[model samples]
Target: MNNLEKWFHSNLGVLRRISQIGALVLVVLIPILNKNEIYILLGNFYSLSIGNLEIADPAIVAQTILLTKKVFLPLLLAGLIPIVITLFLGKVFCSWACPYFLISEMGAKLRSIFKTPQPSLKNPKPQYYWFIFAGVMLFAIISGVPIITYFSFPGLISSNIANLVLCGIVGVELFFIFVILLSEMVFDSRFWCKYFCPVGAVLSLFLSKNTLKIKLNSVACGNCEKLSESPCINACVLNLNPKKENLYPYCNHCFACVDSCQNYGNALTITFQNKEK
Candidate 1:
């Protein structure tokens, strides 16, 4: 195996778990630190300020522009970071740093222990999510309020974390997240990430042909036929067929499929390639 593949094999899910957990820790710790009067990191996922660098969620940025009908230079600059990241890395924030996505993944793991059957809900088309995003933006324009950010699970959960840490109380947002998590466990897995999630939907708009994505080798994948089924597909919580080419706007670049493929034929590898390739 090559060096990259070798590293992926040895590390498996370690790096991702560390990143996800680290993000969760930051969500809570930032508020604690701020409560103690530290200002190095401020704000939550929707909008954050580290040192002098301001980073805002693009979805929220769009809403702000629509609501105010003007663009502030700082807001534009704050929004650029995530857009650049999405251009190069795809919508990795959902998989790597989203607090809600992390909790949802944990629920999926717990269900796996009980040997729960996979949710039979068919995956929605890419346009379905984009339509929701557009509709949300349109509503913000009409209602003169940024409704999308309010419904952003990641932002809401992180804000709630900050609220709990700094203010000593949690809001109704936690209950909303709990309901979503419970529904995911009993019904469809990653239902919100797949279907709704305006943040994910907005981030996906930056996906380009040259962005990072999962690629499959059919010959190596065919070798996986020796087993009952492809482990890559089983590893995908989103129920994506990694052996197929159409992964994106849906893929969070979690690398679960690539890691699972390593045990079989190392068929799936993440690479920067054209989507049509």
Candidate 2:
């Protein structure tokens, strides 16, 4: 195996957790450093400035453009980076760096330990996510308010982190997040990301036939159906079936399934290939 393959084989899960933790740390650290008068990294998830470069959430950028009816070139450019990245890599940000997703995963672990009567892990129709995204955008346009930003859990969490760091008080958004977390812990897992996250919904639109996605080798996946539960499926916090062809829309490219597949015929792989081919 190549060095890259070997590295991933041994470290995919570790690497993903590191990225998730780093994202959380960066969210808090950016505001703290800025409060110390360091201007190197600025802004929250809605809009982030690293040195002279700006990176922003495309969904929010689109909302701003739609609401204000002006291009605002800098904001457009900031949003473009994420769109292009999403086209290439899929909605990896959700799995690798979204603070809310990290928090939800942690909550899921706690739920597992407490052992509540788990609802069926099957996600509702993926169409509901896009419906929420479109509905929020339409509401923002009609109300002349950026209500879409308020609905973005990642942006809200990051912005609230900054608010607490800089202003010494938490925004009400934190309570919104807590309520959702509590609902998921008690009733379902990944309820928001699977059915309601507008940010993820918007990003998923950028995925194309050639975007990176999970591919399953049916031949290599020997007799996993005979097992009570496949290791790869169990490894996925989203409880996704990595072997399924229709996995892209819901799959976050976390590679947890790929890591788990190593001991079980190495059936799952991440690749950039046209789905039609």
Candidate 3:
């Protein structure tokens, strides 16, 4: 890696730290300001707010089917576009757009403060656990129990806060929110994103295809010894060693490495495979 690239990778850790902190603050504060208004904003933009239970959100595909006539356009967009994008571009939404990703990124940062070693990029064994959970949620919705909607944290947090404020019951819900936020300070903030988030699980299924993904050029990499100790790997929030492996399904494509790989001739680039433009 050249001197400039080395410098860029060295500084990327700072940017990742700052962006994560900002995103966490936004996730917590935005819901408090105007939950309904924010819901409308996301809805109009084809992003569903799990908070808006009365309206169909993309998280529950079966619910959307039952309420097809109600939220036709949003439901259609949510159901189809993500699947199609996943066939080629992988889960670009998880990396670039999903609010949950922001929180996960923050969690990764907090893990650093706790001195947790970066997660290995080794192949994550497919568990199919989420598929079973999704099946139960589907059956429950079909049985006329919108139970999943009630317990969704993102939706619950926003809606409960709004209702609490309006009904003057803010103390209890606000207290819960404070506790959740405090937990983030002590443990890994991405805990919610990693294990509990059904939406993320849904996205992961579609992301295992020919999408824009992190790539590593081993020839250019020079095994980190000849270069500056693999800055791209060091900068990755997902703790992936891009030089060693690029196709790890959990990769969010945050482009931190692309920004950090200022040396080694910009070995990583985001582009479509087997396509002539």
Whole-model lDDT values for every prediction: 0.81, 0.83, 0.54
What C-alpha lDDT does candidate 2 achieve relative to the native structure? 0.83
State which candidate, 1 or 3, has the greater lDDT: 1
Q: For residues 191-218, write the lDDT of model 2, one tens digit per residue.
A: 8887678788778888998888777777
lDDT of 3 by residue, 1-277 (tens): 5676556555654654565555444445544555545443233112334454223334566455553426566565657655676667765555554544555566556657777555444523445436555675666666777555543445455445445544546435445535554565566444454445555555666665366666655556555564334667676665555655333455665677777765656677555564433
Cα lDDT of model 1 by residue, 80-156, tens digit: 99999999999889988998888888888887787654533234467767787788888888888779877899899
**Candidate order, lDDT descending:** 2, 1, 3
Clashes of 2: 0
Q: What TM-score would candidate 1 get against the native? A: 0.92
TM-score of each: 0.92, 0.92, 0.60
lDDT of 2 at 220: 83
Once fitted onto the true fold, the runs of candidate 3 whose alpha carbons sit more than 4 angstroms away are: 1-57, 63-74, 81-89, 128-191, 226-229, 243-248, 274-277
Could you tell me which 10 consecutive residues in candidate 3 have the lowest summed lDDT? 39-48
